[model samples]
Target: MVVPAMQLASKIPDMSVQLWSSALLRDLNKACGNAIDAHEAAQMHQNFSQQLLQDHIEACSLPEHNLITWTDGPPPVQFQAQNGPNTSLASLL
Candidate 1:
């Protein structure tokens, strides 16, 4: 995904390269598991770091760089009990 974004960022003017890289890093971190082998973990971290470095370089090259804006989506809606009196646990047993 970072590779595609890097290519696209090159072609598109005013693209937020760092923002895309940051998102990719976040995803990679989330996907990493504690149970993964040491070799695999090292390899994954190295790849991510390299990509981040490349993105930083690309972003720095831009003439007019703007801070990336992050917007939080709407909060999840809470469900309310529509019908009725709560059943006692003892009654169910």
Candidate 2:
């Protein structure tokens, strides 16, 4: 789930607040199916889910310097010293 979220964000041309929300919502619905349902409660829950994912995405997104390489991609130079064999996109500072 974490990897999927990161991939979604990284693919964005520009991670604006609006784009982030809509993209996340679209992906969520596509992966898990639409949230719209016959019951009012279901709609409410769907909204809540979208909001929760939005919040989570924001919370997880830190400064670019704070970002780390999570996948098999090369690690940031800064990570070489502290991250050992692992590479992260952390700033040298």
Candidate 3:
């Protein structure tokens, strides 16, 4: 016997932040009961969801579309070693 093809369906939000934050904490529209632009709403979202932001960053993790900044710092200790036994895998080979 042959089985028929199986299909799956689900609903998704229009914005990524919706997936990032909760409907209760994130207004996105008129956050804090005032009309606001996207940046303003983003600030409001941050204000309302800083705690959730930490939780969300740790839990669900933010998508890499944009807005997140990464700072460059000194390399790891292993990289600082010039000719140590295990200086780095690249130099080893």
TM-scores, each model vs. reference: 0.32, 0.29, 0.19
Ten-residue segment with the worst summed lDDT in candidate 1?
70-79
Scored by TM-score, the top model is 1
lDDT of each: 0.47, 0.49, 0.38
lDDT of 1: 0.47
Candidate 1 ranges beyond 4 A from true positions: 1-36, 66-93
When sorted by TM-score, best at the front, the candidate numbers are 1, 2, 3
Q: Candidate 2: worst 10 consecutive residues by lDDT?
A: 36-45
**C-alpha root-mean-square deviation, each candidate:** 19.8, 12.9, 13.9
Best by lDDT: 2
List the candidate 2 regions with Cα displacement exceeding 4 Å.
1-38, 64-93
What C-alpha lDDT, on a 0 to 100 scale, does residue 34 get in candidate 3? 38
Clashes of 2: 3
The residue pairs that clash in candidate 3, if any, are: none
Write out the backbone clash pairs for model 1.
none
- Those runs of model 3 whose alpha carbons end farther than 4 Å from true positions after fitting are 1-36, 53-93
